[model samples]
Target: MEYKYNKNEKTAYQKGYRVTKEGIVIGKKKNPVGWLHTNGYRRFKIRDHEGKNRNVGVHRLQAYQKYGEKLYQEGYMVRHLDNDCTNNHYDNIDIGTASQNAHDVESERRKERAIHASSFIKKHNHEEVKAFHEKYGSYKKTMEHFNISSKGTLSYILNKES
Candidate 1:
């Protein structure tokens, strides 16, 4: 889905921080110092140049300005495309249904599995998988012996490499 951003949004340079409409929080000469909130979103709390301490989620601040306050309506969630909540860039944030967010999470997990599988094969080779299977007698046990998940990825590696 196409994400929309406000072109008119300007970065606010408050006392020690610069907050962008895309939800980036930079501090102390434009350095990234965004902290993860307890709710798992990136946030910033600082005394703006005006000497007022402001604490808020970068996504909420941007979403409110980009999509408006009504964007907080029921059943809608702000999703990070990369699945890293700390990366609260405006382009990374999207308004999605709960199910859509869950689907994105699953997609990221699959990508992580592919990455892990490729790295493991690169480091150890497929013979290790074959040897584990021979010793354990089953694909599931082989996975346990190797300390990995994604049996499907393991099978693919075995087939393609062997």
Candidate 2:
């Protein structure tokens, strides 16, 4: 699944739009749109070489401005170094493969799972988990009984008080 480079979008960016280091896109008139996409990335409406309005991501635009068209031509995706979709700063973004992007997403998922486990642990102590485990008589059943999602979380809960 390779994505072809969008020359129209690139041309639109190069025509009169400028991206600040903070990821702000300024049009020809130097007006900031300050629009955000539903996925949290900065969005901009610009006219392409064909004079058609097009929506573009600030990260991609910044990457193009900083690294030129080679990235797009090579099928590399713009990735946020800090795994934040909203932080479009030029220095914080880079070009990477789709697999790398998927790894970044997995990293974010791990962080979310950790946060959820932490909150869950705070609400339910080790004694409760132990009692559930004893009644269930199996790790899988114990996890299901307590709504736990992973064996690592169950192990952590069981060992926290030891």
Candidate 3:
């Protein structure tokens, strides 16, 4: 995964078109490019050898500037340590395998799912579910009485109350 920069890119890098510690790309004049991709990563417009404008991720540029080509060798990618795509700060970035990056994203997704499930569960009457379970002394009967679809949901509601 070693990235070979074209002449234009190399020239830009040499001319002070560099990413800062904050993940902003600073041009030769020392002004921020201030452009961001829709996916939340900062982007820089660099002209290719063909003179066509191409967008590059600021994190990639930062990784290259900091760690050089060694970071990209053998399928390694730039990773956000805090799982924040927009936080391109030098200390918040790392070089890792695709699986490591995927694991970070998956961990974030699991947290989001848990938060959503917790909020959804709060919309239900936990006290009523607990009382009904106690009265029936059976999870199946309590779920049936509450019209709950998942036994796990019933268990969660009953257990969460305690």
Candidate 4:
């Protein structure tokens, strides 16, 4: 079944239970504070369905950490070894800690930066980097787009439309 996006709300019915995109009412499926989601429907998390927050993707990773093993399709991070999130093939998915996952992402970012930097340096006639700010499209937009916590990484990439 196709999954739909659901906004979160302060559901009063349960402490941790929340609605999901599949219309299930999952509650505390797995967690100390009891992470909740709608039952039957495994499309979304309670927080996503009920919480009115813009930074949804920030903590969404945690839900995978909290309930990945218990949830269907979403189990084991469903990582795309090739770096595509939508590629849910079983061969691509694997269980890993958030920090570890972040490490993988960082490694990919570094590789991408290296490759892109080389191209930029060569194609742009060595005038690729212009004080960092201009090339990265401002620090705020860069961080938000990358879902990054550390602004310390000296990595760079061309935010191109693939």
Clashing pairs in 1: 15-48, 15-49, 22-90
Give a tens-digit lDDT track for model 1, residues 130-151: 7777777787887776766766
User: How close is every model to the real structure, measured as TM-score?
Assistant: 0.42, 0.60, 0.59, 0.26
Off by over 4 Å in 3: 1-11, 106-108, 111-162
Ranking by lDDT: 2, 3, 1, 4
**Model 2 steric clash pairs:** none
Candidate 4 is scored at a TM of 0.26
For all candidates in order, the CA lDDT equals: 0.63, 0.75, 0.71, 0.39
Q: Which one wins on lDDT?
A: 2
- How would you encode candidate 4's per-residue C-alpha lDDT over 53-144 as one tens digit per residue? 32222123333333442323321333334454433334444554444465556666756655654453444522333335466767666545
Clashes of each: 3, 0, 0, 17
RMSD of candidate 3 to the truth, in angstroms, is 10.2
- lDDT: worst 10-residue window of model 3: 1-10
Error of 2 at 13 (Å): 2.6
lDDT of 2 at 7: 57
What candidate 1 gets wrong by more than 4 Å, as runs, is 1-18, 26-34, 38-40, 46-55, 108-162
> What is the overall TM-score of model 1 with all chains considered together?
0.42
Candidate achieving higher TM-score, 1 or 4: 1
